[model samples]
Target: MTVYKTYTIGVTITGAANGIGPILQNNLGDDLFIPAITTGLTSFTFSTPVLDGAAYSVTQRIRAKAPSQDCSSITPVSGTVNGADVTVSITCVLSTVVPKFAFVTNSAADTVSAFNIDGVSGNLTAATPTPTTASGAVPSAVFVDPTGQFAYVTNKDANSVTVYGINPDSGVLTVIDADGATADFQPSIATGYAPMSIAVHPSGKFAYVANELNLAGGNSISAYSINITSGALTAIDADGATDGNQASIATGVEPYAITIDPLGKFAYVANYASYNVSAYTIDQITGALTPVADSPFAAGSNTHSIVIDPTGKYAYAANGGGDISAYSIGGAGALTQIVCANGVLTTCSGSNYVAGSAPRSIAVDPYTGLYAYVANSGGGVSAFGIDPATGALSAIDADAATPGDNLTIAAGSVPISINVDPSGQFVYVANLFSDNISVYSIGVGGALTPLPTLSLSTGSGPTSVTTTQ
Candidate 1:
């Protein structure tokens, strides 16, 4: 017996010129409908045919308006279409959801390259071939805050930090001055000397900079309280006192790198000249750092970078002496070197893990914390498989011959910095000498493959890279 009776789910959209939707019916499901409206008019209506007595659900597929605008479905959107045509309502409003941008620092050009990143595919769309904003002299490193609201850059020669307000819609960066002064002439905040890298606490309430040298005496960490509203920086009133710089936290000689744990409880610094790691406990409210017990823990020679895992369980340091130093995070944020012997496949082992020459930087996959990548200034990136339980690292595959055979990936000259996209689907490497960025798509079992043309053009001397997603 054939009973051909049908009804439709109608959607009326307000505040938009056109509306397109997907209306799913119980038997004949997943039909596309385009609601049409004349130009300059904001009201529209559309419907798709549905079978009689079939359950239906409707969702907005496209809302023709600014990217920031949003549309939501009203109640009665899903029901059994019995006889007559069913009508539902959709309301359009202004909603902003901007994400996925990449920032790169050019040390020689004194500018930062800004690229808009696609959330689905990690491809980059450059706003300009050249950088749009001018940073301070010798901008060595660039870091984006956790909230993706602002970007901070370190100027080695300028002895300051360049703060930029990130445009939510386009990912364009604009220099921001907290004091309402000129951004081109003066930096947003002053530091001791030669700030190497910057890291913001997990709470997003404070920020710290690793100054390689203090004008007066010992190295210091510049401490600042972050303004939640405007993304501005204000120096914290707290001081390091005896050995600290003026209103800043003090460390050993030439602090080259700094990172806060995922929990926002502890902070760590890698002192390059001192060849050790400095540990500190963060005063959550005051944004102050105090020395942890047995501070200045031993690491490989010439430590250049340090990073804590997303779980806040393990830490890794990239040493210039050609090896990675791994540690387990103690209760108070101190690092204890793990001694996992060879042959432990998944277990953690930081002991005697040799890397390529001049391993300058290291980073863990924040999304999974399952892999780590090292930026070797010698022209390739070393990939490591992180042990989940022990929080140590192991080489991905020792059997593969030559780099790019699945063991390691090749990069351009002087790959000074490396970063993983927020989605953990891609990797970005900044080649300082070659002035290019190498792109790689991560594969199964923690392997990397070239995404496309291998590398993208960058500024004069791209030194640092970071991402938002």
Candidate 2:
């Protein structure tokens, strides 16, 4: 028999822009038979008290009669509430409107997008663009500052970083610093080589970038000191350092992905070339990194992705070689291979087994930490039930269950990445070859049920997908 634990969920909605408060009032009013409306200037009140775990939905409608320059703009909506003693808030902000990729500053396709997220319905409404002082760039990653006052973006092709001041009440963004603004701080030329990823420290004092360095002679990670007031980035110590076994902690061959652990004590990199993973201890005070003993541990062949569990107790790598590797993180930030019960390391400990096929991305459900989804370039995804105590994976249902139309036909082509929403209710896959995204509803048994497929514009080539909360 299996033992299951029950949990309660609580939700609060705030910062409703684009007439979200009125829309939410209407939706919840119909669903719960309660009248709700916007009271004071920007405040929303409920006629009936909301209870914990109660289901609700929100919708926003706005109309601007202006024909030309007399435009109208609605603010981004945000949700904040307590769930299981944890405070979680989701905000929407607007940046540039780019086509073909999963790039959207807030949900808006225009310069300004409304910020509205319904905690009950789990739906989003896109707002019109409202440009501020900030200009547009091809943004690759978005990092919100710890104080929630600002956010930064990595412009890969532009070779620059964009900074914006965040509006707390509306969750909208105004450009604080635009492109080519070098007086604020610039990344070292070497480290700025096609910057692919960015991470902000918990303290909001420092930021890190993973440079893909698509060019001939430059590839490395860079660090920057963030200006809390201006939201600018200034190059920090050892601006551009190669991943070497001696000087810098060497990842396998081509370092494509990087993530810092939850505790902010260690950082891990997935090396695409060396087909391995590198672990490093982070200097909490200085934000410098030193390789751990036995640092570049072997993973499956062509290891391209790594993610730490929410608890910071386990580290997982998705290998292009078609297998997922699980490692037990020691107290000292060292990684020890978690072997199978039979004393072997590379064997299926779970029910859903993945044969050798390029597994490109891995996403773990933050709520349970008991399941993970791996997107394979070959087509399907392998779902693994996690052993929370030992960090081992076992198959849950069966191998690669097709979600939608693919159930009768062949699988979609080359799904590159997978992301589970913060609510842990949906899982999304970015299909590189198909140029589409597949959304699935997660079942209580940790299984995936497919929903309608959403098509992306031609040549969008979405390499990554992240949801803001």
Candidate 3:
């Protein structure tokens, strides 16, 4: 002679329409949750029940007519029934992440090509709102801010930085001035002479540009503070904002490329004619640069561009004279050469790897930093595996015959600017002579698989390419 009883679970959902009825899952399905209030139901319970003292769990798998939201959190998710019922609450919020985008600066056509990167297929399609946006004269390089709110382009002939406001929903570009309209400051924010490359800080509060030529000094770097509310650039003082000789921070001849470390603590520039690299520490709050002690570090001849690895532990300089200069970054942001017995990358001669005919730019994998990619103005892109400990590099075995000896991946005629996407999924090269872009998916073991069909068409002469964060 015994008496038995059963207990049910209640699911209370908030922040959604009251009439929104959905079945709860995970041992609590089979019953429709009407929720509380104006449905006029004070206390409603699920139909399925466990025997008194049995265990139960509630999951956030809403079965019907639910908005796209995450409901992984369920209160009182699992427990044993103690002769009483249990209730779980759920709250829904919408997602804000927009689509990914890629930008290309066309030096010949004076326009920037914009495209949407497909997340599933890793393909580039023309972005909505438009295909290309007008830029200043001879646009050399493009950089998207960390917040994905704006894009800055360096116009070599225009000697200015063009600002474009990125459309959050469509990934389109609209010239943004101080007031978000008119061409007063929207078209060009005057910088130094022949602006070549642009880089933004990790905080998205500042941006810097490399000036290849100037009368104030041989070459200089221009710094600016970004407006938070509106995507505008204001030149910072003592960095050639007003063209004062005393205010300019001079660099070696023809500073062609600039980059900031992942932590936003340091900045480095490659001077083409100087045959060296300049290092500086960034002012976190003010965004100003102070030269590191033993400032200019030696690089290979005719250094065109420099890149700091994702880990911020090493740096590589791409020289137009057909070699890559590798270095280990010191604690104070100084560079020390990684010497190797042999000059070419036939093996892991760490110091300088014999690049293709004319190496224009170099980039390393973002996450592991295990691989490096180079764009050759001579012909194609070269792939190399990075030695993790010594920052040494050797060519990827494309043919499996001449391991670490020859380059196999072919690109456009003058592939100048090369970059790996932030996710480390793909590599993009701006072909200056071919007037197009070459696309490749990073395969296993840091090899490259060219996707000619997915390749993108650009304006006349594409000098630089970059992607949104």
Cα TM-score per model: 0.74, 0.63, 0.74
* Candidate 2 similarity to native, TM-score: 0.63
RMSD of each predicted structure: 14.4, 15.3, 14.3
Clashing pairs in 3: none
Q: For residue 20, what is the lDDT in candidate 2?
A: 17
Please provide, for model 1 over 380-461, each residue's C-alpha lDDT reduced to its tens digit, 9 standing for 90 to 100: 8888888889976777742233453344568899988989876677888899899988877777777777666357888899
Ordered list by lDDT, greatest first: 3, 1, 2
> What C-alpha lDDT does candidate 3 achieve relative to the native structure?
0.75
CA lDDT scores, all candidates in order:
0.74, 0.53, 0.75
lDDT of 1: 0.74
Task: Encode model 2's per-residue lDDT on 372-412: one tens digit a residue.
Answer: 88888876766777887889776554233544322111225
Alpha carbon deviation, residue 165, candidate 3 (Å)? 1.3
Q: Better model by TM-score, 2 or 3?
A: 3
Worst 10 residues of 2 by lDDT: 62-71
What's the residue-level lDDT of 58 in candidate 3? 68
- Please, what are the lDDT tens digits per residue for candidate 3 over residues 72-151? 46454677888887776655443222238889999999999888887545578887769899998999999987657889
